[model samples]
Target: MDATELQAISDTLMRIVTPDMTPKQLIKAARKEHPNASKRDIARAAFFSIIANADQDHGKAKNLQAFAIAERTQNGAE
Candidate 1:
């Protein structure tokens, strides 16, 4: 997806994200509003959110950054 779509997804994520939520949980939440949003799309949104909202919430940004990294790595994920 392009930057605009990523931005919109990121905005949605920022609204729905909770402190204890996992990446999987975040994706499921995001998909509620964006039915066609892929895992990759959500992950990309996490990354974008991290950058755009870095100065807003440190904890939230950190969580999103972790999610983005998890998406790109193998880490024996199932």
Candidate 2:
């Protein structure tokens, strides 16, 4: 995805994510505003968001990174 799409997904994730939210919940929530986003796209956005958000919320950024890795590897995604 392009930077604009990534930014949009990142923005949506920032708005929708919560401490209690699951990976599936995160993806679903993000997709509501950006239905064309793939798991890879969301994962990229999550990683992108991490750099910008780590200082303010390390745990949230870590969770998002973990979710991104999971999305990339789960069920033999490759």
lDDT of 2 by residue, 1-78 (tens): 888988888877777778788889999888889999987789889988988788988878878877877877883655
Candidate 2, which segments miss by more than 4 Å at Cα?
75-78
lDDT of 1 by residue, 1-78 (tens): 888888889999888887888878988899999899888888889888998998999888888888889887844475
Colliding pairs, model 1: none
Worst 10 residues of 2 by lDDT: 69-78
TM-score of each: 0.86, 0.83
RMSD vs true structure, all candidates: 2.1, 1.7
lDDT of 2 at 54: 85
Candidate 2 is scored at a TM of 0.83
**Alpha-carbon local distance difference test for all models:** 0.86, 0.84
Once fitted onto the true fold, the runs of candidate 1 whose alpha carbons sit more than 4 angstroms away are 75-78
